[model samples]
Target chain A: MNFSYPEFLVKVSENCIKCRRCIKECSFGVFSWDGEKIKINHEKCVACHRCAACCPASAITILKYPVSFKENHLWTEEILRDIKKQADTGGKILTGCGNDKPYPVLWDKMLIDACQVTNPSIDPLREPMELRTYLGKKPEKLEFWHDKSGEIKLTTVMEPQIKLETPVIFAGMSYGAVSLNVHLILARAAKELGTIMNTGEGGLPQELLPYKDHIVVQIASGRFGVNLEYLNSCAAIEIKIGQGAKPGIGGHLPGEKVTEEISRTRMIPAGTDAISPAPHHDIYSIEDLRQLIYAIKEATRYRKPVGVKIAAVHNVAAIASGVVRAGADIITIDGFRGGTGASPKVIRDHAGLPIEIALARVDEQLRKEGIRHLASIVASGGIRSSADVLKAIALGADAVAIGTAALIALGCHLCQKCYTGLCAWGITTQKPELTRRLNVEEGALRVTNLVKAWNLEIKEILGALGINSIESLRGNRERLRGIDLDEVYLDVLGIKPAGR
Target chain B: MKIDARGMHYRELNERIHDAVLKGIKEIDIVNVLGQRYIGTGIGEKVTINVYGTPGSDLGAFMDGPVINVFGSCQDVIGNTMNNGKIVVHKDAGNVVGLSMRGGKIFIKGSVGYRTGIHIKAYKDQCPVIVIGGKAGDFLGEYMAGGILVVLGIFGREKDPIVGRFIATGMHGGTIYIRGSINKSHVAHDVSIEEIDENDLSALKNIIQEFCDAFGITDPNSILSHQFLKLRPKSHRPYGQMYAY
Candidate 1:
């Protein structure tokens, strides 16, 4: 007996010309063309709307299934559905994407300040607004001296920094989780935007080697495809300690998804589960992390900056500080709202801290320790729009990483069914027919447009705030205020109330 | 080139090695190398390095292509994530030897500490091989995905068991060969242990012959006379059934 209810109601309107396009367009197999007319099994609809959008007559309609259980606040339809699913399968309920629970979104509760007639706003249209940002360790102080020839030379040795035309970068999304076309799009967009795209755990394919200058290769616990060439062929190295979606848990990419190409790229067998353990078995302590970090530095001959990425947990500040002291040039803090291709639903919704509080506390703690300049902080997870990026920078991030938002720009409807390997948008699936639908050039253009629009909006907001440089806004919490937020959150965020 | 790293820091010693390699030095020897870490790290050249004294942790880490001959013992993580190279250790080594090594061959003349050969994997043709002349500590070959691991247990430690408990735990790929028998209770549940057949014996013979030649042992046939038990993961996907999907 099936105890599941349809989440969406699909209807074929009277305007249907019976083109049979819906049956072919829907990768989820929601619609079927009978001998007479088109019929829909609403249970299979993920609400991707590819058919509705592609229809010439616009005959298809998709609506949320107008059904409800008993009026119980504690046990909502989502809770009951999950319970029923577990009861039926006796397996852990898995989900994709970020936390969907209605926890407080601190970004919405925080407001940015604008200069009102006192410090006159700068017109970004005509003025030179600086958005060029560099990510890496900075020396505590700079010293310069005039040579005998009367030319000033820098005395302090500067560390390697990753220059970003804009402070926003594409987050790490692996190849097996998404298709190669998606990676191509990200790499192309990153090159055009002058920002790096992370190769999340999955190894960089041979074709993407041309974009090596704009790629940050990730080394996860699985150690998949991590070799000398892979390590050296990147702008920077990111040792992924944990992910925000599934903190303290390992990742298991099933054998079914491990195609021959994926196997070659990851350097694993063609049909084996790529299991990334919870922790790097050898890295048991902070000292061990230091050893690994220094080892990578030694391997790269100190050319590229090495970073450590950890989930934004309760003690994220301390952990980030340890990461910096352990010789990391960058620290990437991923919050609970970070997206994943697939993860256990229990951990996805319940584990890790929000990026807002995590970034603020980490910035505050590192500043107090007087080693904030030792490494650049990249705050990720749940950055929605340009306003969120600005707020993140003001709260203390040197830059921000966007994953879900970037996917949305590439036609992701956020149905959260990426685990099924049946993405109608062709963004997260590897099936040949589905993956071919995502034209790499079009996807790259969309991502490039999104980043450009966000960058322009950021400049507009900076002009209104009377700041011409993005660096001047970083860690400038005085330019921000908490709106209807608790005193504890305000204190942690290092901001006052809205009226103040 | 000869480097006397008596009191030199790991960084300086490694930098010297890097410089020597860059200078196209084919062969270099370091005498009195007392605990200098990351020796020959990331050196992709086909160079040979001979170490007189004990090297420090993470020796030959991420080394693409190089040969390291160690006269004395080594510290922990001797070949941490080593890519392609040959590391021949004369005596004992510390824990976590060959951790996550994708491609390489590590030949130890004597015993090794705990968690040796943990998480070592193999690519298409680049299969990593680790041969222990003596015994291995606990958790041997834990989480091994691909590659071959052989524990000879021939260096005067044959009275006790060859390997410690929880052998090949969570191992999904790879093959483990241990000379003599192992207590079945010590192995993981998903692994299968069986006596070597003709083909297995032939491959094991080649690996043993190489291990003996590395240490200049006279009797390769003596080690071959003993029965070898082969350990392999029962299924390629160990956690295939644990997931809901």
Candidate 2:
């Protein structure tokens, strides 16, 4: 296949020094020196803007194409035209954000019919609408009795103790992959929002140690910076078995970005390439995953909930069932369109199943197995709006994690420039100036605003549905309806066609 | 001090080691510890640990400043990412040995598995070195940006001088020296190979002699009798002018 670079803005500047820094820095070989001046091959560029950032005299500038053509159309006419063209070509639908297709967003399609005639829609101004969610296993059998001292002794002491005021969470973004400022922003946002943000497999930064209660630490294959203390310093622990973008493959952080600080944080040698091995050396089977889960549980003394995170794949329902059987408190599934710091392009575009199908299947399978309530499900990978959240919960997820969406709230344009390590928005880079662009205070406020908006929207939906609490919406498949879907999709989603 | 961990698992051995260290034990003697994985994984601080038997994969992975001296054979990923520490292994180790190691000295008294010293780098005063007493497995020093890897094939008795393919693949910097003839076809297209002259030989001899001294090899004379081949990346300007408009 012939390869063509994505279109980018080219501004010709006379201040070219021909230093060849762009040539040296680009991993994709996007720039070349033509003896007298540096030349950029636009076709090869992924629009990462590393060259523009590295240019000493600021001779290079990359301008992204405007995504919005008109205000009311939702998507630009060009994007709509492109979507139709893809459909005409019999090609798979490809999009960046959480399910950007014209499919009737179930959250938007199903109007909550408020009972203005019979039941009163409780005023949120005076009455409380509880958004608080406890994500862990609930006891199957409860035995309450009095001890010899006449004190009530509970049969089980809730296996894990992670509490969230809001059902929303910020997903994993490691320190080395993202800047410390970004992590701090996410942590502070979680703390302020009464939620949690995961420390994506790269280990927790020392600066974010104080917000330990708001953090969800991860243990991956590399185990680069994991320790007993690191494990204990989190509200929850996630075992990153696979990522949505590149499910089967591992990760590689180039030596150039592995600076002294990143090195120290990751507990690896500075300036050496950090390679996360393809498979967990210790985990070969579901039984082995259980051993690791129990080991971590034993290590943490059951203080924090243990979550198994996997990419949403074809066999996700079966896999999630296995995870539930392994005694995991929660299971997080990331769909195909998930974000990544660095992953092979082939893997990013090809691997994993969609989040919608995976969520529905896993929920159905768990409910059928009579263990649906044994573990809570958290769906991630391209969750963009409150509508998606409602649809996710309706599909059987207790909550959802938002990584790319959170970054967008903090000024990311979804430029897919994270792998380049020169993200202009400061969400994905460690460079001081670029990182400074993302003010942690302002970023936290943006995140808080986003989640706050979503929470209000959830309340509005609930109020319309004549429900006061989010628990009523959980696994309420009766509220969802499928549109323009085939027999297989209908059967898989267990949804009837619209108007039926 | 003598602990036989022949059939003991990684968790059990790690627990025992943790307990011993907590009890203020300065030195540990581990015996018959066959296939026990992650022997000293993520242990921060200095301690003298001696292993009398074979250890499993990632024997000293993510180890910080601890002297791990193994008196027997070890498996894959020995001394992986070990920063500021010393690992002296008396027997051969398995695949991808010393992968991405940054700051440390790994002196193997025997041969190593494939991709030995791959992606090994250096920063400032911290330069990692891996000295192999025997021949290395394939893809030795692959993608190595910094540091040095010295493979002293004590004698060329092993079949297929370097076992594996694509030696020094993607290597942009760093040096790899082997004391035996490497088939020209096996050398990666990206790497430049040259015979080590007297000056290079002397530097290699010093490192090999250190390995000999640590492992009780009385003579470095026979080790020096073989010719040395050095591999370096052909281009600091790799990827060529692919980006030129």
Candidate 3:
């Protein structure tokens, strides 16, 4: 029962007021007053800076533990600590919000091309640059009609589309994983930014019913809170096959977090674990997926577009092709390093591929098979900056979804303790006391500003490339060049070498 | 609206039904409805569909508002992912019935196959209900999230038993009422059996009367005399410790 392996060191300065404010503000029990003087428990500190930020005396400083395990390849500090923690507590190794391991990040190695003297780059401050994107299936060919009197008739039917003001959307995060206030903030931001935020498997809370048009409800294997009214209330429905954080694995939201509010929204009993089976029992094959797709289509009367979201596994190209062929109008691919409320460390660190490679391969395969226009591809998982968004579009993505970035805008330091349900930030936890830390109206304004700033940056990039619209940049791999990538990566990305 | 679905394809039949519904018809009767899959799939309308013969699988998948009455037996997935609706069968039913049904009611006159009413759920005011008059195969009401499932041993022989083993496996939510006793070996790990009480009996009787009226079962009073037992999940988080341990 004594498996305390805190990773932070707390230092109290001489300027301490002895007011014990740190003891009161620290949610993780890192600071305490033993009836006399305030004491810091280094073992309990997650370094979330809740106490440090709240302290009025400016007396507390926090740092990582200045200890080493010889730094050997066979015995890294993380490996040693993880083994010790499990051996002592006999608990599953839990982590939050994507892979934090030091893996090779390809986005840092790719560069965008700008126009030279041959083609003058337009000034974004004066020139008009469009960032709008439409997501849905486009027909392969258009039909033409002419009048009998030799006058051409202008007419064509268009399928439903998700028109995004900027090619950025808030990714799906279940209500169980985050507080209701977080959903509201993300919803408000999506509404203001002219994008969408997914109601990840948790179903839409009734309070946010007014923001239904900006919400994308999800249908995972668990079928939580899925009903006729809930399905009809969203802009679209996403069939969640897998997530990058834990591909091919199931999900279990602990019973302790399922309060009355979460229980009502998820439509499950309070204090019961909400478990999602790894796969949909009925959909064992692509044909079965097609059946469910059409079933939803039939249910909605073909009004809203239906989408499929999958993790970027090694063979994602072929899987995406099968998904589109199965009648999905939009495809969402989550790469490794995607965020999660809770996931096993082993799976989060080692399961899936990068979004860049997966996006390139899927687009190339879809284009090669003459089915590129069948569905719109939305890339997700670890899209950090506006530059990454532009690079994803160049690699052939209609849009991108951001999860951890949005949380950062909402005051998350990524201490990576979301699974513990004791978040110092109010974004992830369901506890009433902790969730009160967020001011949703202000948080929503911050998120809206963040996205708007990113949109302006995107327009700047487009203007620098002499491109006036985002559609012209879509799948234009010629504008991107690989720097550190070898021949195979460059070939798979279908881009030239940087020097070339 | 009437359709002679003899040897007609399911697509064409569905199209005709869709057109008829769009045309504002409130009732449709289909004759010779044999082995046609997805009969009322994805139909979101308040209407009545009367089927003369046995229909195929997925009778009302993702159905929102409608009533489907089958004069004969039905097949698998009678209400797969159905939201709000009602489906009535005069005789037995097939496998995997009511998979992930959020809200609705299903009544069958006779026995049913395996995995019936798996993952039936409820949200807010919408609670799904499924009632069977006779025996059932194994895994009945497995993984039911929130809803009501009832099985009556009216048509089964004394030795047949009401349902096969492993009933209510992984059932985290909901209640199952059964006439006659179930052996401890037949029950799932997470389920617990309890003696039926007054409120339970009243609810059971109400659903039984509805099922009797739908299936033309005479003397519905006979079902009240049978010893009814209730099965519910022992814990909402049955596997909470499995992952950590």
Best-performing candidate as measured by DockQ? 1
DockQ of predicted model 1:
0.71
TM-score of chain B of each: 0.97, 0.90, 0.96
Model 3 over residues A1-500: C-alpha lDDT tens digits?
Answer: 65444678899898898999887777788888888778778998887888888889898999887764566897887888888877776777888988988888888989999999999998889988888899898977777788899887656677888888999999999998999999999999999999999999997899889999999999998888876787789999999999999999879888898889998888877787787878876677898788778777766767899999999999999999999999999999999989999998889999999888999999999999999998999999999999999999999999999999999998888888888888888888988888988998999999999999999999999999999999999999999999998999899889999999
lDDT, candidate 1, A341-437, per-residue tens: 9999999999999999999999999999999999999999999999999999999999999999999998888888898899988888989999998
TM-score of chain A for each candidate? Answer: 0.99, 0.81, 0.97
lDDT of each: 0.92, 0.76, 0.88
What local lDDT score does residue A66 receive in model 2, on the 0 to 100 scale?
44
In angstroms, how far off is B240's CA in candidate 1?
1.3
TM-score of each: 0.98, 0.73, 0.91
DockQ of each: 0.71, 0.07, 0.42
Top-lDDT structure, candidate number: 1
Q: Pick the candidate with the highest TM-score.
A: 1
For candidate 1, give the lDDT: 0.92
User: What does the lDDT come to for candidate 3?
Assistant: 0.88
lDDT of 1 at B93: 91
Write the residue-wise lDDT of candidate 3 on B1-245 in tens digits.
89999999877888899899999999999999998878888788998999999898878987889999999999777898888889998888888788888888998878888888888876668788998888888988877778999988787456777899888888888899888887778889779899999999888778888888887777778988889889999887777764431
